[model samples]
Target: MIIEPLGGSYDRKAFSCGVLALDQYLHELANQDVKRRVRNCFVAADRDVDLIAGYYTLAASSVPITSLPEDLTRRLPRYPVLPAILIGRLAVDTRYQGQRVGSILIVDALRRCAQAAPASFALIVDAKDDKAAAFYCKYGFRPFQDRRLSLFLSVATALKLFG
Candidate 1:
Protein backbone atom coordinates (compact mmCIF):
# COMPACT_ATOMS: atom_id res chain seq x y z
CA MET A 1 0.00 0.00 0.00
CA ILE A 2 1.05 3.60 -0.59
CA ILE A 3 -0.09 6.85 1.00
CA GLU A 4 -1.13 9.75 -1.19
CA PRO A 5 -3.07 13.01 -1.09
CA LEU A 6 -6.85 12.66 -1.27
CA GLY A 7 -8.13 13.20 -4.81
CA GLY A 8 -11.27 13.02 -6.91
CA SER A 9 -10.81 9.50 -8.28
CA TYR A 10 -9.98 7.72 -5.04
CA ASP A 11 -12.58 5.31 -3.66
CA ARG A 12 -13.84 6.81 -0.41
CA LYS A 13 -17.10 4.87 -0.24
CA ALA A 14 -15.39 1.55 0.39
CA PHE A 15 -13.47 2.90 3.37
CA SER A 16 -14.86 2.22 6.81
CA CYS A 17 -13.11 1.95 10.14
CA GLY A 18 -16.26 0.69 11.84
CA VAL A 19 -16.99 4.28 12.84
CA LEU A 20 -19.85 5.98 11.05
CA ALA A 21 -18.59 9.47 11.76
CA LEU A 22 -15.10 8.83 10.42
CA ASP A 23 -16.43 6.98 7.39
CA GLN A 24 -18.87 9.80 6.76
CA TYR A 25 -16.11 12.36 6.97
CA LEU A 26 -14.21 10.68 4.17
CA HIS A 27 -17.20 10.18 1.94
CA GLU A 28 -18.91 13.50 2.53
CA LEU A 29 -16.45 16.09 3.78
CA ALA A 30 -12.86 15.19 2.92
CA ASN A 31 -12.98 16.56 -0.60
CA GLN A 32 -14.76 19.69 0.45
CA ASP A 33 -12.21 20.33 3.19
CA VAL A 34 -9.40 19.85 0.72
CA LYS A 35 -10.95 22.30 -1.73
CA ARG A 36 -11.43 24.87 0.99
CA ARG A 37 -7.79 24.44 2.21
CA VAL A 38 -8.99 23.50 5.66
CA ARG A 39 -6.96 20.40 6.37
CA ASN A 40 -4.72 18.19 4.32
CA CYS A 41 -6.08 14.64 4.23
CA PHE A 42 -3.86 11.75 3.23
CA VAL A 43 -5.08 8.31 2.25
CA ALA A 44 -3.39 4.96 2.28
CA ALA A 45 -4.48 2.80 -0.64
CA ASP A 46 -3.54 -0.60 -1.94
CA ARG A 47 -1.72 -0.20 -5.22
CA ASP A 48 -3.31 -3.31 -6.71
CA VAL A 49 -6.88 -2.99 -5.41
CA ASP A 50 -6.97 0.84 -5.51
CA LEU A 51 -9.02 0.77 -2.31
CA ILE A 52 -8.43 3.12 0.56
CA ALA A 53 -6.83 1.25 3.47
CA GLY A 54 -6.66 4.13 5.96
CA TYR A 55 -6.40 7.92 6.20
CA TYR A 56 -5.51 10.86 8.42
CA THR A 57 -5.85 14.63 8.35
CA LEU A 58 -3.40 17.31 9.46
CA ALA A 59 -3.74 21.05 10.08
CA ALA A 60 -1.71 23.82 11.60
CA SER A 61 -2.58 24.68 15.20
CA SER A 62 -1.29 26.01 18.49
CA VAL A 63 -1.39 25.25 22.20
CA PRO A 64 -1.34 27.69 25.08
CA ILE A 65 1.51 27.08 27.51
CA THR A 66 -0.86 27.77 30.37
CA SER A 67 -2.86 24.75 29.39
CA LEU A 68 0.06 22.38 29.66
CA PRO A 69 1.28 20.63 32.78
CA GLU A 70 3.81 22.45 34.91
CA ASP A 71 6.62 20.06 34.07
CA LEU A 72 6.02 20.56 30.36
CA THR A 73 5.59 24.30 30.76
CA ARG A 74 8.95 24.55 32.52
CA ARG A 75 10.76 23.25 29.46
CA LEU A 76 8.99 25.27 26.81
CA PRO A 77 9.84 28.79 25.74
CA ARG A 78 8.34 31.72 27.60
CA TYR A 79 5.93 32.36 24.72
CA PRO A 80 2.29 32.03 25.70
CA VAL A 81 1.47 29.84 22.71
CA LEU A 82 3.41 27.17 20.94
CA PRO A 83 3.11 26.28 17.25
CA ALA A 84 1.85 22.82 16.45
CA ILE A 85 0.39 20.57 13.79
CA LEU A 86 -2.87 18.88 14.66
CA ILE A 87 -3.68 15.34 13.61
CA GLY A 88 -7.33 16.08 13.18
CA ARG A 89 -8.35 12.50 12.58
CA LEU A 90 -6.88 9.09 11.98
CA ALA A 91 -8.56 5.82 11.12
CA VAL A 92 -7.86 2.54 9.40
CA ASP A 93 -10.40 0.40 7.54
CA THR A 94 -11.58 -2.53 9.68
CA ARG A 95 -10.37 -4.81 6.92
CA TYR A 96 -6.89 -3.52 7.52
CA GLN A 97 -6.93 -3.55 11.31
CA GLY A 98 -3.88 -5.08 13.09
CA GLN A 99 -1.89 -4.56 9.88
CA ARG A 100 -0.02 -1.46 11.17
CA VAL A 101 -1.74 0.86 8.68
CA GLY A 102 -2.59 3.39 11.37
CA SER A 103 1.00 3.50 12.54
CA ILE A 104 2.20 4.06 9.00
CA LEU A 105 -0.24 6.90 8.48
CA ILE A 106 0.92 8.53 11.72
CA VAL A 107 4.57 8.29 10.78
CA ASP A 108 3.75 9.79 7.41
CA ALA A 109 1.90 12.66 9.04
CA LEU A 110 4.80 13.38 11.39
CA ARG A 111 7.30 13.26 8.54
CA ARG A 112 5.23 15.70 6.54
CA CYS A 113 4.89 18.07 9.45
CA ALA A 114 8.57 17.88 10.24
CA GLN A 115 9.42 18.89 6.68
CA ALA A 116 6.85 21.65 6.45
CA ALA A 117 8.10 25.26 6.38
CA PRO A 118 7.56 27.78 9.19
CA ALA A 119 8.22 24.83 11.44
CA SER A 120 5.90 23.65 14.17
CA PHE A 121 7.18 22.63 17.61
CA ALA A 122 4.97 19.63 18.18
CA LEU A 123 2.27 17.31 16.86
CA ILE A 124 -1.08 17.26 18.61
CA VAL A 125 -3.99 14.82 18.45
CA ASP A 126 -7.37 14.72 20.14
CA ALA A 127 -8.13 11.11 20.88
CA LYS A 128 -11.76 10.13 20.38
CA ASP A 129 -11.58 7.79 23.39
CA ASP A 130 -9.33 6.04 25.90
CA LYS A 131 -8.33 3.37 23.41
CA ALA A 132 -7.31 5.99 20.88
CA ALA A 133 -5.41 7.81 23.63
CA ALA A 134 -3.51 4.63 24.43
CA PHE A 135 -2.60 4.16 20.80
CA TYR A 136 -1.04 7.60 20.67
CA CYS A 137 0.60 7.18 24.07
CA LYS A 138 2.38 4.16 22.70
CA TYR A 139 4.08 6.58 20.32
CA GLY A 140 5.28 8.78 23.22
CA PHE A 141 2.48 11.35 23.13
CA ARG A 142 1.75 12.96 26.48
CA PRO A 143 -1.59 14.36 27.59
CA PHE A 144 -2.07 17.90 28.82
CA GLN A 145 -3.13 18.28 32.43
CA ASP A 146 -6.47 19.74 31.45
CA ARG A 147 -7.35 17.15 28.82
CA ARG A 148 -6.50 13.51 29.03
CA LEU A 149 -7.64 12.83 25.48
CA SER A 150 -5.60 15.64 24.00
CA LEU A 151 -2.00 14.50 23.45
CA PHE A 152 1.18 15.94 22.06
CA LEU A 153 4.65 14.90 20.88
CA SER A 154 7.42 17.29 20.18
CA VAL A 155 8.54 17.67 16.57
CA ALA A 156 12.13 17.12 17.65
CA THR A 157 11.19 13.74 19.06
CA ALA A 158 9.18 12.78 15.98
CA LEU A 159 11.97 13.76 13.62
CA LYS A 160 14.38 11.58 15.52
CA LEU A 161 12.10 8.63 14.82
CA PHE A 162 11.16 9.46 11.19
CA GLY A 163 13.43 12.18 9.92
Candidate 2:
Protein backbone atom coordinates (compact mmCIF):
# COMPACT_ATOMS: atom_id res chain seq x y z
CA MET A 1 0.00 0.00 0.00
CA ILE A 2 1.84 3.08 -1.26
CA ILE A 3 0.53 6.61 -0.99
CA GLU A 4 1.33 8.88 -3.94
CA PRO A 5 0.04 11.61 -6.22
CA LEU A 6 -2.62 10.74 -8.78
CA GLY A 7 -1.09 10.02 -12.14
CA GLY A 8 -1.74 8.56 -15.58
CA SER A 9 -0.57 5.19 -14.38
CA TYR A 10 -3.29 5.05 -11.72
CA ASP A 11 -6.42 3.10 -12.63
CA ARG A 12 -8.92 5.84 -11.87
CA LYS A 13 -11.74 4.46 -14.00
CA ALA A 14 -11.87 1.26 -12.01
CA PHE A 15 -11.93 2.96 -8.63
CA SER A 16 -15.28 2.79 -6.83
CA CYS A 17 -15.82 3.93 -3.29
CA GLY A 18 -19.58 3.15 -3.48
CA VAL A 19 -20.28 6.87 -3.62
CA LEU A 20 -21.25 8.23 -7.00
CA ALA A 21 -19.84 11.69 -6.33
CA LEU A 22 -16.49 10.45 -5.09
CA ASP A 23 -16.23 7.92 -7.91
CA GLN A 24 -17.10 10.56 -10.51
CA TYR A 25 -14.62 13.02 -9.09
CA LEU A 26 -11.66 10.70 -9.61
CA HIS A 27 -12.72 9.66 -13.07
CA GLU A 28 -13.81 13.04 -14.33
CA LEU A 29 -12.78 15.92 -12.09
CA ALA A 30 -9.68 15.13 -10.05
CA ASN A 31 -7.31 15.81 -12.92
CA GLN A 32 -9.02 19.10 -13.57
CA ASP A 33 -8.51 20.16 -9.95
CA VAL A 34 -4.86 19.16 -10.18
CA LYS A 35 -4.32 20.98 -13.45
CA ARG A 36 -6.00 24.12 -12.21
CA ARG A 37 -3.65 24.25 -9.19
CA VAL A 38 -6.58 24.26 -6.82
CA ARG A 39 -6.16 21.02 -4.88
CA ASN A 40 -3.64 18.22 -4.84
CA CYS A 41 -5.05 14.70 -4.98
CA PHE A 42 -3.32 11.72 -3.43
CA VAL A 43 -4.16 8.06 -3.65
CA ALA A 44 -3.47 5.01 -1.54
CA ALA A 45 -2.71 2.46 -4.22
CA ASP A 46 -1.77 -1.14 -4.55
CA ARG A 47 1.96 -1.80 -4.95
CA ASP A 48 1.58 -4.47 -7.59
CA VAL A 49 -1.59 -3.23 -9.22
CA ASP A 50 -2.36 0.36 -10.19
CA LEU A 51 -5.77 0.17 -8.48
CA ILE A 52 -6.57 2.85 -5.92
CA ALA A 53 -7.55 1.61 -2.48
CA GLY A 54 -8.49 5.07 -1.26
CA TYR A 55 -7.89 8.72 -2.08
CA TYR A 56 -8.05 12.28 -0.69
CA THR A 57 -7.58 15.90 -1.75
CA LEU A 58 -5.92 18.74 0.12
CA ALA A 59 -6.19 22.49 -0.36
CA ALA A 60 -5.65 25.75 1.46
CA SER A 61 -8.60 26.92 3.57
CA SER A 62 -9.56 29.26 6.38
CA VAL A 63 -11.78 29.34 9.44
CA PRO A 64 -13.42 32.25 11.21
CA ILE A 65 -11.85 32.79 14.64
CA THR A 66 -15.24 33.35 16.28
CA SER A 67 -16.43 29.94 15.14
CA LEU A 68 -13.91 28.32 17.43
CA PRO A 69 -14.57 27.68 21.07
CA GLU A 70 -13.87 30.59 23.47
CA ASP A 71 -11.22 28.55 25.23
CA LEU A 72 -9.31 28.21 21.96
CA THR A 73 -9.99 31.72 20.64
CA ARG A 74 -8.71 33.31 23.85
CA ARG A 75 -5.24 31.90 23.23
CA LEU A 76 -4.92 33.23 19.68
CA PRO A 77 -4.64 36.60 18.05
CA ARG A 78 -8.00 38.23 17.35
CA TYR A 79 -7.77 37.71 13.62
CA PRO A 80 -10.98 37.43 11.65
CA VAL A 81 -9.81 34.29 9.89
CA LEU A 82 -7.21 31.64 10.54
CA PRO A 83 -5.27 29.68 7.97
CA ALA A 84 -6.07 25.99 7.57
CA ILE A 85 -5.55 22.98 5.33
CA LEU A 86 -8.74 21.38 4.06
CA ILE A 87 -9.22 17.69 3.47
CA GLY A 88 -11.62 18.34 0.65
CA ARG A 89 -12.61 14.78 -0.03
CA LEU A 90 -11.79 11.29 1.20
CA ALA A 91 -13.10 7.85 0.19
CA VAL A 92 -12.14 4.21 0.27
CA ASP A 93 -13.08 1.69 -2.39
CA THR A 94 -15.75 -0.77 -1.43
CA ARG A 95 -13.29 -3.57 -1.93
CA TYR A 96 -11.01 -1.94 0.60
CA GLN A 97 -13.57 -0.41 2.94
CA GLY A 98 -12.97 -2.48 6.06
CA GLN A 99 -9.23 -2.80 5.59
CA ARG A 100 -8.29 0.61 7.03
CA VAL A 101 -7.73 2.27 3.67
CA GLY A 102 -9.65 5.35 4.79
CA SER A 103 -7.60 5.42 7.97
CA ILE A 104 -4.34 5.24 6.06
CA LEU A 105 -5.31 8.03 3.65
CA ILE A 106 -6.58 10.31 6.43
CA VAL A 107 -3.42 9.88 8.50
CA ASP A 108 -1.34 10.69 5.43
CA ALA A 109 -3.48 13.77 4.76
CA LEU A 110 -3.08 15.02 8.35
CA ARG A 111 0.67 14.49 8.27
CA ARG A 112 0.94 16.39 5.01
CA CYS A 113 -1.13 19.25 6.43
CA ALA A 114 1.08 19.36 9.52
CA GLN A 115 4.21 19.70 7.33
CA ALA A 116 2.79 22.05 4.71
CA ALA A 117 4.52 25.23 3.57
CA PRO A 118 3.56 28.79 4.63
CA ALA A 119 1.99 27.41 7.80
CA SER A 120 -1.62 26.70 8.74
CA PHE A 121 -3.32 26.77 12.12
CA ALA A 122 -5.36 23.63 11.58
CA LEU A 123 -6.79 20.96 9.26
CA ILE A 124 -10.48 21.01 8.37
CA VAL A 125 -13.05 18.71 6.79
CA ASP A 126 -16.71 19.19 5.94
CA ALA A 127 -18.00 15.72 6.55
CA LYS A 128 -20.52 14.40 4.05
CA ASP A 129 -22.73 12.77 6.70
CA ASP A 130 -23.02 11.72 10.28
CA LYS A 131 -20.97 8.60 9.64
CA ALA A 132 -18.28 10.70 8.07
CA ALA A 133 -18.44 13.07 11.02
CA ALA A 134 -18.05 10.16 13.40
CA PHE A 135 -15.09 8.86 11.44
CA TYR A 136 -13.34 12.21 11.67
CA CYS A 137 -14.20 12.60 15.33
CA LYS A 138 -12.29 9.38 16.02
CA TYR A 139 -9.16 11.26 14.97
CA GLY A 140 -9.85 14.02 17.54
CA PHE A 141 -11.52 16.44 15.13
CA ARG A 142 -13.88 18.91 16.79
CA PRO A 143 -16.94 20.45 15.15
CA PHE A 144 -17.23 24.05 14.03
CA GLN A 145 -19.90 26.04 15.85
CA ASP A 146 -21.99 26.55 12.73
CA ARG A 147 -22.22 22.90 11.75
CA ARG A 148 -21.71 19.55 13.35
CA LEU A 149 -20.59 18.00 10.09
CA SER A 150 -17.88 20.59 9.61
CA LEU A 151 -14.86 19.78 11.75
CA PHE A 152 -11.23 20.68 12.35
CA LEU A 153 -8.12 19.38 14.04
CA SER A 154 -5.42 21.79 15.08
CA VAL A 155 -2.02 21.34 13.45
CA ALA A 156 -0.48 21.66 16.90
CA THR A 157 -2.29 18.49 17.91
CA ALA A 158 -1.34 16.75 14.68
CA LEU A 159 2.31 17.56 15.29
CA LYS A 160 2.13 15.88 18.66
CA LEU A 161 0.48 12.80 17.17
CA PHE A 162 2.86 12.52 14.24
CA GLY A 163 5.95 13.30 16.22
For candidate 2, the TM-score is 0.96
Q: RMSD in angstroms, candidate 1?
A: 1.2
Q: Which stretches of candidate 1 lie over 4 Å from their true place?
A: none
Scored against the true structure, residue 48 in model 2 reaches a CA lDDT of 81
lDDT digits (tens) for residues 21-140 of candidate 1:
999999999889988999999999887888899999999999988877787778777999999999999999999999999999988988898889878988999999999999999888
* Model 2 C-alpha RMSD to native: 1.0
Number of clashing pairs per prediction, in order: 0, 0
Taking all chains together, each candidate's TM-score versus the true structure is 0.95, 0.96
User: Which model scores highest in TM-score?
Assistant: 2
TM-score of 1: 0.95
Assess each prediction's global lDDT (C-alpha) against the native.
0.90, 0.90
What is the C-alpha local distance difference test score of candidate 1? Answer: 0.90
